[model samples]
Structure formats: structure tokens, C-alpha cells
Target: MVKTNAMRMLDKAKIEYTTREYEVDEQNLSGSHAADMMGADHGCVFKTLVLKGEKMGYLVCCIPVDGELDLKKVAKAAGDKKVEMIPMKDLQKITGYIRGGCSPIGMKKQFPTFIEESARSYSEIVVSGGLRGQQIALQPQSLIGFVKGRFASLMQD
Candidate 1:
């Protein structure tokens, strides 16, 4: 398995994680599809999202593939009036990772990060590994601490 910047960052931090790689399907690059490819539970697989806030500029959000991000809740957590997803074209420039490969760890710069509160229910969750066809599974708390993230009601009911 190829080591991505995210995996390296975790290694440097002495964070324990397991990497899983799957076949990439450009036409169907959804987290749920990735979860299916890895034979992982969809609820345990997270998709990292980058958003631009009215006041904060940029922020990172991680939520389960099966859930939807509550923009209002994210704005509240970010202390902004509103938040919108960054354009796909600007994703790499802003986060140094492309669409199907963005990770909460090892971005060009660490922006404020929020993980869905439900993540606390899982001992370990899967996140992108800074590259397509790769993922990292680690304790949610460890990931939250490493990224200096807070648990928020990020997902929609």
C-alpha cells in the first residue's frame, strides 16, 4: 500500500491507524461506494468536506457517508452566518487533496475541524487517506485529538 501524506502525519504523531485500499471508480466516487468496496460498514465510513464560511474563510467537516451535513449546524459550530461547500475545482488548491481523496489530517494548513457527534459512538472510523483508493481507520478520539477537532451536531436529522 502506498503511504499518503495523511498516513505519514499520523505516523509522525505516533497515532495508530490501519490503511485500506480499494479499486477507484471515477464515475462513481461516492463514500458509500468506497465503503462497499472495502467491505466496511457505511456508517463507519466518513467523507471529509471542505467549506467556506462567511467569516472563517475555510473549515473542515467530517461526517458519516450515510449522513448529510447540516449547513445551519455547521455555521453555528463555526460561528459564521453561513457556510457553503467549496467548489470542486478549488479543492486541491485549498486542501491539497482532490475530491474523492480529501482527508481531515495533513491538509496544506489546519483549518478548524468539526466531526459529527455521532462519531463518538464508534471506536474507529474510516476516512480518506489523502489519495484515491486509500483509507485510514483509527480511533475517533485519536483522530479528533490529532486534528484538534471538536464534536458538533454536524449531521442533519
Candidate 2:
């Protein structure tokens, strides 16, 4: 398996993680689909989202595949008046990752990151491995520390 920047970073940090691979479906690169392909629980699989905050510039939000990101909560957590998802066209240029492959770890620059509070209930959570068809499973607290992320209520009703 190819080592992505995320994996390498975790290695350098002495963090333990396991990688899972699945076939990428270009037409449907949803996190739930990836979880299903890997036979993993969707609630424990997260998708990285890049958002632009009015004051903070770029921020990364990681939430469970089965949940929606609550923009208002995100903004409050980010200490920004407003936040909006970055355009797909700007994702690569901004984070050095494509649509379905964006990982909270190993971005072009370390933007402020926030993970859903629900993740704290899990011993380990799955996140993109910096590429499609790949995922990295690791302790949630370890990941939060590695990315300098805080737990926030980011899920929508």
C-alpha cells in the first residue's frame, strides 16, 4: 500500500493506526459508501470538510459520515461570525487534497481543525488516508492531538 502524507505523519508522531482499502467509486465518493465498502460502521467513519471562516480564513471540520455539519455550531466553535464550505475547485489548491480524499491530517498547511464531539465516544475512528479508497483508523484523542483539533458539536439535526 502507498504511504500517504497522513500515514507518514502519524508514523513520525509515533501514533498507531491501521489502514483499510476499498475500491473507489468515482460516481459516489461519499463517506458512507466508503464505510460500506470497508465493512465499517458509518458512524465511526468521518469525512473531512474544508470551510472558509470569515475571520479565520480556512478551517477543517471532521464529522461522522452519517451526520451533517451544523454551520452555525461550526462558526461558534471557530469563533467566526460565519463559515461556508470551500468550493470544490478550491479544495486542492487550498488543502492539497481532492474532494473525496481530503484528510484532516497532513494538509498543505495546518489549519485550525475541529472534530465532532460524538467521536469522543469511540476508541477509534476512521478517516480518509489522504487518498480515495483508503482509510486510517486510529484513536480519536490521538488524532485530535496530532491535528491540534478540539471536539465540538458539529452535527446537524
TM-score of each: 0.98, 0.98
Candidate 1, residues 1-157: lDDT per residue as tens digits?
9989999999999999999999999998999999999999998999999999999999999999988999999999999999999989999999999999999999999999999988899999999999999999999999999999999999889
Per-residue lDDT tens digits of candidate 2, residues 5-104? 9999999999999999999999999999999999998889999999999999999999999899999999999999999999899999999999999999
Off by over 4 Å in 2: none
- Clash count, predicted structure 1: 0
- Tell me the whole-model lDDT of each prediction, alpha carbons only: 0.95, 0.95
Which portions of model 1 show Cα errors greater than 4 Å? none
* Lowest summed lDDT window (length 10), candidate 2: 61-70
Global fold similarity of model 2 (TM-score): 0.98
